[model samples]
Target: MWPNPTIPLRIKLSGTPREIGLEHGRQLACQIRKQIEIYNTMFKETSKLDWPTVRDIANEYRVTIERLTPDIYAEIAGIANGAELDILDIVALNCRSEIALGLFSDGCSSLGWKFKDRTLLAQNWDWTASIKDNLVIMSISQQDKPAIHMVTEAGIIGKIGFNSSSVGTCLNAIRARPTDPKKLPVHVALRVCLNSTSAALAIAQLEALGSLASAQHILIADSEGPVGLELSPMGDVYLKPNDHGMICHTNHFIQNRFVDEPPWLSGSPIRLDRMRRLASALVADGETVTREALRKKIFSDTFNAPQSICCQEDPLRPLPTRSSTLFCIVMRFAPSTRPTAQIVWGKPGSGEGDVIIMP
Candidate 1:
């Protein structure tokens, strides 16, 4: 029922981890199974990872996730049970990058800007076009914390979203190597950030990752402010709005422990430079920035053809590894006005925007 104008699956679960996982598994059985199979073949061929090795790596991260947050593990277990799949399959789905290396490295182009009375965060999620069917907007309600709302792939527990607590997060995958399966993966960390009550708390959660694999930029913001933090196995970098009132990130590390690490995604530096120039031009013109302008900039495809921000399918990328811009999401968080988000179902350049209030 998900993938509707709003969310098809407006799920609300509050109970034990098993209970939550089971309900989630049952609710998304079809999509979950589909996602697992696609990832299985991709992982096997791309990373030379067998099912057993993938499982072993996932289980290792499972232990780390449980040690850090048992509730999430229980939820994952429930998903496995409900979906009628091995727990290791669910683990591998969450930790797909750990085993498959660069298989799923292409991610998003994102930023956060200070609006007059609220905070605005936006991004373009680049993923395998086949996974479009795996998209779902999940709303999770636990006992005491604020409910979490995320636009995620079926089996993945996190990607992008906000919470009733007013905290919001966005992510962009950085293609750095030497991933430490011992620490938290980006998906798990996103879930952890979703539960945070404030911006500071969300950042604290990231700071606590110790070391992480598959480096990524985690941009967080509440009504008060925004913080851009990059996490990797070696070290970390934290950034904020520039004098121009903007913080932007693409699929590369702005700063990191690995000084010489090359840009993971081919389009990363290109997009980063493009967005910076766009932001600078906006500031220099002294023009009033609106949501429309921001979206237009994100949807720009001036650079590298198929791999540009408003990406279209490429002829060179084989069918399985080929990806495109799945969606463009813009969120506004203000204490006074109910949080509102605008989403374009396909490439922002091609589709119209749909506005939804965070429930």
Candidate 2:
């Protein structure tokens, strides 16, 4: 039997109408319930969810209900929050491995007139394994209105996808600097991205968020062939050329402006080193030039010991002492292909599932 199977669900919503009314709220709540049922069924798990049940889950997670306005949005947000709890419960039941690390990411667009317009993409990998797989869902309406975008995988709700509005995003552990718990969790940032519809809008959101957690590097890619390299604390942003046909980002900042600290301090030195080695190997093998070659290189673990691409609970250090977990994720955007290409490390059943397509 599979050690543990986590379900991943990704959705894309567009052309949704935004209006506030009791009927609208009821419809939104029904949609949220459907999403929850889909997530639970996907993982063969059970979830105790209702409008009120979901609301309580959101409250327990400390998620803000203000953004989930329009009554329907609020109900949907509550369901999304409850989905997160279902994922946690599943992990507690089936996770046989010690110290399973989970990761979450979000990319948001068009929030509050562009004050915080940047998409928020984050990695939440530490003590618990993030939702079964990297799952992201989003909803976008006409400009100047609230939309509902909910993401859940293996019963966990958050953000994890790249679609027409925005690109899927992930983070590489570059620095192991201590962070404050009071600040917003990285998962919240991923949710922010799921809420966005464009790269420009996502960037604006990041800028408006200001500084919450410690300094870290964010890698964002949009369906429009835009790849962004941004830094927190300093709030520096850089853009890469998508004209080259394809773009691939691992853990580490490509920009010189971003400093590279010791992995001991960054908690990803070895993983970063491994990613560098993989990149170098790919270049040596002449795979760096092609998108397929790059994907092959990312999955290669020639070193054997201390598997370069595998996720580690404690990478040469304890959790409390380490900055973040070392997990591997490769986001590839190839519009030339019939459908968008997305491959995540953990999905369901297979442990490593096939590439998921978003249309």
Which candidate leads the pack in lDDT?
1
lDDT of 2 by residue, 165-189 (tens): 4456554433423333323334455
Candidates' RMSD to native: 2.3, 10.5
Candidate with the greatest TM-score versus the true structure: 1
Model 2 residue 145 lDDT score? 33
What C-alpha lDDT do the candidate models reach, one value each? 0.76, 0.36
Cα error, candidate 2, residue 330 (Å): 5.0
lDDT of 1 by residue, 170-280 (tens): 988766677887788788888888888988887777677574666778888888868898877777788878876589888777767673456556777887887788877
| Candidate 1 TM-score, true structure as reference | 0.92
Candidate 2 weakest ten by summed lDDT: 106-115
Where does candidate 1 have its weakest 10-residue lDDT segment?
1-10
Clashing pairs in 1: 1-8, 2-8, 21-78, 21-79, 22-78
Q: Please identify model 2 stretches exceeding 4 Å from their true place.
A: 1-77, 80-158, 173-185, 223-230, 233-267, 280-285, 288-292, 302-304, 312-339, 344-359
After superposing candidate 1, which stretches have Cα over 4 Å from the reference? Answer: 1-10, 209-211, 300-302, 352-358
